[model samples]
Target: MKTLLSTNLIYSIMAKEAFVKEAADDILRLTEWIREVFEDGGKLLIFGNGGSAADAQHLAAEFVNRFLINRRPLPALALTTDTSILTSIANDFSYDLVFVKQIQALGKPEDLALGISTSGNSVNVVKAMETARAIGMKTVAFTGGTTRPGGDLAAVCDLVLNVPSDSTPHIQETHLWLEHVICEIVEKQMFGTT
Candidate 1:
C-alpha cells in the first residue's frame, strides 16, 4: 500500500516537472493571450468531455468569479454546464456537434475557445475548435503528450498546453493545477496585484 501511494506520487511529480520545463513558455504565452482577450472585451468559452468537462467548468468559474484575489468577474463560460443545451445538441444533431453548435452561435472573432482533452483527440473538442477557427476565435487546448503531442487538438489550437504524461490521472491532475496557475496569473495581472 505504501509503495503504491509513493509510486503514484512520484509519477505525478515527475510528470508535472517535465511539463513545467517544457510548457512554461507556452503557459506564459497563453496567459498573455487571455489578458489580451479580456482587455479587448472578448469572452472565453471552454469545453471538453467527461473529466475534462469538469475541468473546463472549473477553469471557467475561476475566470468568471475569482482566482486568488478580489476583482470584477471576467467574462467566461463553460459550454459543458448547460444540461439542456448539451442534451439537445447531442440528441438533435450529434454528440460531435454539441460544442460545434455552441461555438457557431456564441463564438466571435474577438473571443477565445479553450478545449480540454486528455487524449487530445476528442471528436467534439476538435470539431468545436475547428468551428472556432473558422469564426476567427483564438483556440487553445490542454492535453497529454501521449497522443502525438496533443493529437488533432494541438493542430487546431493557437497554444497547446500538452502535459508530458500518458497517464490519464496524472494528466488530469496536472491540467487542474495548470488551469489554476493560469487563473492566478491572469487574475493578478489584470487586477494589478502582481
Candidate 2:
C-alpha cells in the first residue's frame, strides 16, 4: 500500500510538471485574449459543470466583484448562478439547452463566452459556445488535454486554452490558477495599477 501511494504521488507530480512545461505559452495567449475583450468593452460570460461550474462562478466573481486588487466592477456573468434560470430552462427545454437559451437571450456581438470543461467536452457548454458563435460573440474554452466529444469547442473558439494534463484534479487546480492570473491581468489593464 505504501509503495502504491508513493507511485501515485510520483505520477501526479510528473503529470503536473509536464503540464506546466507545455502550457506556459498558451496561458500567456489566454491572458492576452482576455485583455483584448475587456479593452473592447465586451462582457464576459462563463459556465461549466460540477467543479468546473464552481470555477466558473469563482472566476466571474473575481471580475464582477474584485480580484487581488481593488477596482471598479467589471462586466462578467456566471451562468451557473440563478438557480431559477437553470432549473426553468432545464425543465422546459432540456439540460443541453440551458446555456444555449441564455446565450441567445443575453449574448451580444461584443461579448465573450468562456466555457470550462476538464474533459474538453460538455454538451451544454458546447451548445452555448455554438450559440455564442452564431451571435458573433467571441468564444474561449478552458479544457483538459484529452480529446472528448466537446473537444471541438476548442477548435471553434477564438481562443482555446487547454491545460496540458489529463488528470481531472490537476487540470482543475491549474484552471483555477489560470483564471486568477487572467483576472489579475484584466484588473490591472482595466483599472490601472489595481
lDDT of 2 by residue, 41-156 (tens): 88889999999999999998998888978877888899999899999999988999889998998999988999998887788998899899999998989887654523767766
| lDDT of each residue in 1-194, candidate 1, tens digit only | 99999999999999899999999999999999999999999999999999999998999899888888889999999999989999999998899999999999999999999999999999999999999999999999999976499888888988899997889999999999899999989988889783
Off by over 4 Å in 2: 1-16, 147-150
Predicted model with the maximum TM-score? 1
lDDT score for candidate 2 against the true structure: 0.83
| Candidate 1 ranges with C-alpha deviation above 4 Å | none
What TM-score do all the candidates reach, one by one? 0.97, 0.87
Q: Look at candidate 2 and tell me the lDDT of residue 2.
A: 100
Query: Model 1 misses residue 93 by how many Å?
Result: 0.8
